[model samples]
Target: MQPAVTERDLNQADVADAARYLAGRIVPTPMLGCPELDELAGTRLLLKAENLQHSGSYKMRGATVAVGRLAAAGQATGVVCQSTGNHAAAVAQAARRHGLAAVVVLPPDAAPAKVARAAAAGACVLRADGDPHEVVRQVHADTGYPVIDAYDHPDVVAGQGTAALELIEAAEAAGTPLDALVVPVGGGGGAAGAVLAATGRGIDVYGVEPYGCDSLARSLAAGHRVPVTPAATLADGLRPACVGALPFRVLRDSGIDAVGVGDDAIAHAFRLIVTHLKLVVEPSGAAALAGALRVAETSTHRTVGVLLTGGNVEADLVGRLMEGSAA
Candidate 1:
């Protein structure tokens, strides 16, 4: 396995390199837009539809890179990871593709669809009610499997950045350069990647979190990492109790703004995305749009980019959300 990469070892150039490495390997999900949605936001909104990405989320990019490295090293027989949902599924799928045994530790209350996806990809799915990180460490120690951190690993961050890199490039190609970029923050991996991808490009990056689950926002305010017992919210994927150490290192003093969105706003964004964009975005992904609309309200950003991070929500939840919208 590779040595652990420090934040000092990562930079915008790494994101560029990751994009190159991922070219033709991961899905280049389309940059989509809807006039009605844009009009509602009062700006030109470019949505990076990572919900359409492989493994049903942008997490596939990072999982593939991290697992591919382990496979290439040939020193490890398997891989282990812990996540609320998407990362586990992505790592499972990536390991399967690379012919590596995979074990995923998830919370007992993890989304059913997400759990099914990981199992479907041939991973040994385990449930732990306690801290998943501790379980991951134990799994690594016991099985000798390299642990692919969902948000902290440098390669993972670099891989996640490719999604934002593609979005920025697509926006430029379309002659509507983005003034800002918005991404949902769980452990802040994707947001940190966004900061890297938009560096030197003058695009302001915003990390969105569910209101009571806003560890990133709270950490920024505290000027250090602050842990929160995440509250119940529609965006289950955004419920990490703390922003990841590596991601915090990348985001601290990076001038990236943090936005706290509520479940009501997330639900509204979900409705808009489904109704106008015709996309099956999970509430966690919808938080990006909710945060983008908030940014549009307070800033002069004419062109904004939002990364719709994933689409692996439960079917019943979708029906309930849609039904709620109709009522």
Candidate 2:
């Protein structure tokens, strides 16, 4: 038998260290229950509301942790990062708090709301014509402070893990040991962390990806990181082409599977979440719940955890989408 692939397993100590690294900075996003979601899925569904996070997503956790770590090490000049949306806002917000300058490289097609928010948070925003990921790399190479990656860095991965750490703890306290933890996979930090945390707690983990851009799913099937080709999806935050190197290592070693959901399902989830839950979650953020709704046939449990990652969609876009299909 092949030696069990146990390389990316993270221990309690590692989780504890990550928690401490983000203790007083990032918001402790709440794990919430939805009877409607439960009724829809025929299983109890708990939503971890990272949309309420300070920067409107769990990206802030990783951005804050990585920047804070650099600051503690006396390398805090300023920070540079790239994003289609949430990660730029995250880096801007965290950089502001850390007393560091922030320069964000954003795609020309990034959400207007997020672009303005990043500007409001005091980041020098640059519009890039090429790929957002490549722009991130170029900016990092040119700037010296530290690059706050969207999902690939070890520090970012560690920090993103805290969301699951907090979620599981809260779930246990409420007497609901999660049967599965589902998370959106853009560059894969959140899903990677969810797998590490959920498996550690003996809960199954699932990584949800957009059919418009299913990097994690493609990567997993190919047994290597794969870059996603351009496609049109409203999940702006899920537009990254490839899973992050560090996060991919964790996902592969942990044996977590990826689930692909169509844009229609994600749109439906957006409508359902906002109409029923009164929470305006971004399409990428809602991808995990979309997966749960579609992946129940593969599961063996009655309860699941879904990371509601952000609520940063543009109002006009939401209006257009809602008018089209109520999704």
Task: List clashing residue pairs in candidate 2.
Answer: 228-241
Please give the RMSD to the true structure for each candidate, in Å. 1.8, 4.3
Off by over 4 Å in 2: 1-12
The stretch of ten residues in a row with the least summed lDDT in candidate 1 is 1-10
What range of 10 consecutive residues in model 2 has the weakest lDDT sum?
A: 1-10
Tell me the deviation in Å of residue 103 in model 2.
0.9
Clash count list over all predictions: 0, 1
TM-score of 2: 0.92
Residue lDDT tens for model 2, 186-270: 8888777777666657788888877858888888888999887847876778878788887887787787878888888888888
